[model samples]
Target: MDQPAIPRPRGRPRRFNPEAAVATAQRLFHARGYDAVSVADITAALGINPPSFYAAFGSKAGLYKQVLERYAHTGVVPFRELLRSDRPVADALAELLEQAARLYAADPETTGCLVLEGTRCIDAEAREAARNFHLAKEEALRGFIAARHPEAAGRLTSFVSTTMAGLSAMARNGYGLERLLASAEVASCAIREVLSTSEEHPS
Candidate 1:
């Protein structure tokens, strides 16, 4: 006698790549911010259920941290390279700001630096996560400047960091590329003046 027919599996099987999931989460987090996107939202985006999501990332925060890691690598401008160049500090910094403007406005949907936006996230752990990277960039700039203009190092580093935040905010606020570039040009001029005065005082 023929055996009873076996039952077919239920709805669509979970179809998502763990690596691809991180990228998808990155887009969502970048566009909507961390607190705004829910575990359910990620699960839906990844085409997986809550159980699968937990298995893959542990939690929403865990996924966000992973996304942050990916974004930190790919999303921001590579200032470290510019800072390392033998070019004069003022010139390197001007290029750095110009690159920042381009990166921040590269995508209208995900305008702004991911880490900067994460600093405002509701979760304390996430905020600390972002802060670590932010502070590292600041320290790198400070060291580069201190090597040449020690007196102006702290002040100029602060200036660059503040200007970067403003650029990110403007990009997110729908400022076009031209406008962002204009802002960066003004910042570059400020950098030149700062360097000029630092050279004049030499203390």
Candidate 2:
């Protein structure tokens, strides 16, 4: 009296390399943005079906959340490292901006910062997700500046964030690395000027 074998599930195997899927999806999202890349697009790109995708990520937003985390670790600049407390704050910030420009324009096919660009996404959840990363970066920048230049922290942080956003937009609009570097240099100059002013005024 042997027991009957359990019936195998139908359709494509419910197995996919989640890490590989995230890597593939990051490229898609980076190239086309959040709203533009649909679940079907992701599935077709990954050679998997909706059920597999859902089982792996729960939903499009769920996958996007993972993608955002991946981008933060891999795609984004290492802010904590670059904003070293031992170095002059202005120089550190200048280097950070230059690095960002090069990275944003590094890939012509996938221009702009993924997390920054994702902030403008139409999906509320995705947009909020990106914003969380954006806000965290902002706080980090602020803290770095406040350590040395408490008075200039607020304005300098704002200026740096705004410049990075502009650089991201310009890169997305086909600006080459040379032009982006020029923009970054101009931003660096502005940051130095602000710091100089703050030092001179002593307020």
Candidate 3:
């Protein structure tokens, strides 16, 4: 008589790479907002099982936090370099907004900024994850402006943040680069006015 064969385990073989998984998740989250994506979607895309996904990421929010960090470090504007430049405050700010318009409209299919979109995410933890990047940007802007015009740093940072939000929103709404550039030009004028007025007031 022949011996009975032993049955093998059911689920797919585990070959998940956390870094590669993060990169894949980053794309899915960027293409579709955080709330829109699910663990099942990620697992399916990465060719892994549900248990493997949970074991690798802990939870959806956990993976999202990692994705947000990756996006902040790599995707968003290079604010530290741009804001800390040797150019005049008004000129630097104008360049900053102009650069933002270019980036926001770079890809028509995947428009808008990942960090900015996260601000409106329904998940509280996700929202905070995004806000941290925005706050860091504002702080960088504050430091740059304070070096030149100490009195106007707060207001100027607020203005820059608002303009960035608007630019991202317009890009997501299908606005082209030309329109975004026009908006950026108007914002640049406002920046000039603020700095010029601060110089005059000296309060």
Candidate 4:
């Protein structure tokens, strides 16, 4: 049999670092809320032009959504997973605060969460999407609470969900790990008080 010669590969693939671009976008997005970050800002941050950005990410909104997905899968997922841990609810809540602390300790310019920051910027469609995401997170936390502490599920669900939102705001406000832990301890104490109060009243 005659051996066919293998063809050499063609020219080099287009050179662009999507991860770098995304990280830049994430930083810019966090620094300024979604509405404040124009396409030009993204391009300027990535050191690229509008055409290149659109070519790479489809659109500004597309890139925004992608960065959001990155945060959701990486940041938010772990927060929700803490609620699912076999540890006690207070411990799980503390775990979430600990993770928040770790994030603060890691990122020098960390500015809390995007969804919390963008909640006001989101339009009708984006608001709906945010709502769904929040609801899903609540359901996950609630499921864990129901499974682990049925009697306190309702109160704990409300407490965790509401304070999660507040924690994101606190992060945006430049609250450090120590301040956040102090706030968490206070919130935990209040939560326990409410739980105990509710148990007594059964209302």
> Which candidate has the top score in TM-score?
2
The reply for model 1, stretches above 4 Å from the true place, is 1-15, 200-203
Ranking of models by lDDT: 2, 1, 3, 4
List the global CA lDDT of all models.
0.87, 0.91, 0.86, 0.69
Off by over 4 Å in 3: 1-14, 200-203
RMSD of 2: 3.3
Model 2 stretches astray by more than 4 angstroms? 1-14, 200-203
Which is the leading candidate under lDDT? 2
Quick one: how many clashes does candidate 4 have?
Answer: 0
Error of 3 at 33 (Å): 0.9
Global CA lDDT computed for model 4: 0.69
- lDDT score for residue 58 of model 2: 94
TM-score of each: 0.88, 0.91, 0.87, 0.76
Candidate order by decreasing TM-score: 2, 1, 3, 4
Tens-place lDDT digits, model 4, residues 16-68: 69977887887787677777788988887788777788889997777867777
Better TM-score candidate (1, 3):
1
Q: What tens-digit string does per-residue lDDT give for candidate 1 at 106-183?
A: 988999889998888899988888888799889999988887788899999999999999999999899998999999
